[model samples]
Target: MVPDDLLLETRDLTKDFGGFLAVKHVDLRVRRGAIHALIGPNGAGKTTVFNLLTRFLSPTSGSIWFEGRDITRARPAQVARQGVVRSFQISAVFPSLTALENIRVALQRARGGTFRFWRSDRVLEGLDGRALSLLADVGLEDQRDVAAVELPYGQKRALELATTLALEPSLLLLDEPTQGMGHEDVGRVAELIRRAAAGRTVLMVEHNLPVVAGLCDTITVLQRGSILAEGSYAEVSRDPRVLEAYIGAQA
Candidate 1:
């Protein structure tokens, strides 16, 4: 049984593709309501780990447990329904849709109302009030009517996060939540991520060390598909193995 204090745990997680082991025997534990970060050099299998956790890709070996339930074989949709929702590396917003509409769509998907296509727009109007509230929570209320494609890149990501929040996930997985943004946008999104993590467990694979240090309570460093070090930012930053790995990856 999963401990009451733990929200997500993985045991000996491994993944292989045609004799190429991408992730190797990863044992991870995330505390309830804590913000944890997975950091590694390039090709360290961060993305593979995320895919495994979300059930987007099945593991070649190992077990995944959430809230004391074994979910290693759970389908992607089933895992999502269990409150483990992930935001994509790329924005998931509908470019053509207005920001409010995009959030409404996510709210509808969470409520299992997507099949009601025959319902008039008036029916969807009921979602507008709730959607607006969500947008306000993300500081996107003024841009609610703006086309997602036309919004600045940072705001686009905010909309995507708002949509993900619509699912009311207990465990949220973020993959590079602050990639490809100007310094200002990075700070903004970092704040947004911090706000989103309230009362929820967040496990993120992030490349920006400064952001990770600023926001994550704990950090796990992976080197060549295996954990090299796990600790707070100050602890891992001074580790020789982590320093060597980062240097080698850059070299």
Candidate 2:
């Protein structure tokens, strides 16, 4: 049985791609309402773990439990419907759509409305207030009418985050949220994430150690497809093995 404080749990999770074992016997537990980070060097299978959690890829072994319910066999849509939503490493938004329009579309989907582009404009207008609020939450209110493709790269990522927030996920999975950005944009997005995580749980695979240290409540370090250390930033940062496997490798 999963503990009451745990929002998500994986037991001995493993993934095998033919002869290559990408992830092996991993146990992950994300506490409710905590910002947890998974950090690792290249090919340490951080993204693979995210894929398995989101049901984008099937796990070769082990079980996934969310809110104490086994979700190992759940379909991707089913998992999403249950409020486990993920954002990719790459920014994902409608390139041709205006920022407001993009957010409105996400609102429609979240509210279970079918996509009906031909619907009366008035029908969609009902969602504008909420969409605008979300845009403001991400500091993109001024760009509401700007096309996503035309927005600067940082703003584009912020827009993508807004759309993801529309889903109102209980457990939000962010993959490399600050993968490509300047220092200023990184700080902005980091603040946005902190605000967005107020009432929800976040599990992220992040490469930026400073962001992970500042934002994550718990950090899990992976190396060669296995967990090398799991603890607070202070604890794990002092671990000699973690230093050698992840921090040292990066240096």
Candidate 3:
């Protein structure tokens, strides 16, 4: 079992791509059952860090520990099986599939049943109840039969989230969960994430400051691939270096 004290931790995490240091020495700590936000301006390497953590990119150096075990060398599938899952910036919904079918695929994956993909989808009837419940959890019950591509942009994002939750992840890494959402959709997705986080840990990279302030218990601000500040929203917002970084980024 992962230690209750720290569900995920990084030690001097760094990543370089052909001499271009995308992520510098970074130490991240996420507590069990907490919502943590990693915020920074563009080019600060937030996504690069996510890639390293998920094993999408091999780190030039450093280590990642999940559930108190070193996962720096683990494959993406291996890390996912260890209960760390991530949602992409673009919704991972299948455009041609119905929302329910999309969620069923995730359920099948969580059960390591992907090998059965060659079989008829009717083979997945046993997962319907759980898929329906997940749909309801994300307020997509009414649209369960709708094609993912036909749903509104916001609902598509909701569907993506439901699929991720299907994995029963211990640590859910959301890369910009509210990216490109309008005001109403942003509020809705924020609430959805809030509700989904119960009994699990969430570490997200979000640019929506209000959403971060309202939902996250801890915030780590990255600048130029290094931590600029670490604190609550109020505390980080007040930091001069963070203010300068944002200002400089915008300029």
Q: Judged by TM-score, which candidate is best? A: 2
lDDT of each: 0.90, 0.93, 0.91
* lDDT string, candidate 1, 1-251, tens digits: 35688889999999999899999999988989989999999899998999999999999999999998999999998999899999888877899999999998878876666777688777788788889999998889999999999998889989999999998999999999998888998998899889989989999989988999999988999887888999899999899988888755766
TM-scores of all candidate predictions against the true structure: 0.95, 0.96, 0.94
Give the C-alpha lDDT of model 2: 0.93
Worst 10 residues of 1 by lDDT: 108-117
Q: After superposition, how far is residue 134 of candidate 1 from its true place, in Å?
A: 1.4
Model 2: per-residue Cα lDDT at residue 187: 98
Clash count list over all predictions? 0, 0, 0
Q: State the lDDT of candidate 2 residue by residue for 29-77, as single tens digits.
A: 9999999999999999999999999999999999999999999999998
- Which of the predicted structures, 1 or 2, would earn the higher TM-score when compared with the native? 2
Off by over 4 Å in 2: 115-118
- Which stretches in model 1 have alpha-carbon errors above 4 Å? none
lDDT head-to-head 2 vs 3, winner = 2
